[model samples]
Target: MSADESSQATALITGGGTGIGAATARRLAADGFHVVIAGRRRERLDATATAINVDFPGAASVIVMDVTSDASVREAVAGISRCDVLVNNAGGALGVSRVEDGDLAEWQRMYDANVLGTVRVTQVVLPLLRRSPRATIVNISSVAGESVYEGGGGYTAAKHGTSVISETLRLELNGEHVRVVDVRPGLVHTEEFSLTRLHGDQAAADKVYEGVDRPLVASDVAECVGFVVGLPQHVNIDTLVVKPVAQAAVHKLYRAPIDWKTEA
Candidate 1:
């Protein structure tokens, strides 16, 4: 992979204040792409941009954006002229409740951020993407998007919409230079994802990954995004399902200590 150190290539990441988004911004910036990170928090965005600019000066920019709002997305995106890569990583789960007892409002927020938010941003950026010689849109979906579980009612539905959108858009954009990538990650250990979902219950969030060995980190997913975008525009990785060795599937997880020795 080569670096466009001239800052001609632009990659925009939503929910980029922290976690996977921030890591992706750093990786992309290191690869010589001008990175624009968008999120609702000004402070977090600034921190990420500052960190990136340390190594790649003048390669990081931040835009305050709320994906759920139309005006916010439009106004934020209007500042940039070209976008070669867009990473939709702005959404998160609210509650882990069964369908029978799920909170309707929580579901709404999930849909707005995970599903509709992608639509709103894509609608506005379609023209800009079309103009790019080699463009790719990466949606940070989840394992929940592929299959359902007992307590994943709202999140799963929303992510399923995200997964399908990636599928539909790929077909819709046939013959175009743009590539739609759906990155579904499983058992990623992140700072805010579970805390925000559990309403700031630190202990509960900690226990969610307790006993699991080497769960995927935000940077691990960032590495995936970096590799995908670095590939030739003609090569497309349609759907990538990422999980640690501890996780073989949604229902299957090894909680015991995993042996690291590789048999020769």
Candidate 2:
């Protein structure tokens, strides 16, 4: 919730504790934005902020926010004096239960976290964002938002809601100066993402990236965000879909061991 004395533009990232969120915080800080790293875990938020400050020196702040809560989002954004960029990076998948066997509670958790969470944060922060000459809102969605598989019904449905909202908001704010970007990433190999989705099954999580030649990392998506936000306000990238070379589509993936060290 802090900004620099220089009145630097502020970039607020929800779920900034780890993964692509943490990486985005660092990339934006290096690019000269006072980054507010917000998440539910104080330790993770502090760590991301500390890492940013190490190289950029007071370029980061931490806000403990649970995006699923209205009160939390309100209190968290209320403390910020200014917000030039908002990254809706919170929310995660809880399980992969098939449609017929889906747990109602798990479905609700996925929906609340991925869809409603984005809505809550954006609603409170719009006023501050309007103050900036060139404000930007980036929603970190997933390729699942665009497609559906057997066991991915709940997560995909929630992400589709996210995708729809981003599109709807962009249209609603047509004349407004704010830029809305929907970033969709596929097959990213992160420490906690698959593990959490598989309900702490480390073995299953590890299998998610097995034999894939360098599935996209957090930094890869972070770099995409950096580029999108850095662009001139006049040029708006409506939607960006990013995935590893091994993944041609959500259903298509080359999972064999790939050796790129030698000649083809």
Residue 228, model 2, lDDT: 96
Query: Which pairs clash (backbone N, Cα, C closer than 3 Å) in model 2?
Result: none
Candidate 2 lDDT at 82 equals: 92
Candidate 1: tens digits of C-alpha lDDT, residues 1-264? 124432388898999999999999999989988889999999999999999998989889889999999999999989878888999999999988999999999999999999999999999988888888769999999999999999999999999999999999999999888999999999999999999999999999999899999999999999999999999999999999999999999999999899899899
- List runs of model 2 lying over 4 Å from the truth: 1-6, 259-264
In the range 1-264, model 2's lDDT, one tens digit per residue, is: 433522889899999999999999999998989999999999989988888899999999998999999999999888889989999999888788899999889999989988999999999999999999869999999999999988999999999998998999999999999999999999998889999999899999999898888899999999999999999998889899999999999999999877677866
Clashing residue pairs, backbone N/CA/C < 3 A, model 1: none
> Could you say which candidate leads in TM-score?
2
Any idea what lDDT model 2 has? 0.92
Off by over 4 Å in 1: 1-7, 262-264
TM-score of each: 0.96, 0.97
The deviation in Å at residue 94 for candidate 2 is 1.3
Candidate 2, residue 65: how far the Cα is off, in Å: 0.5
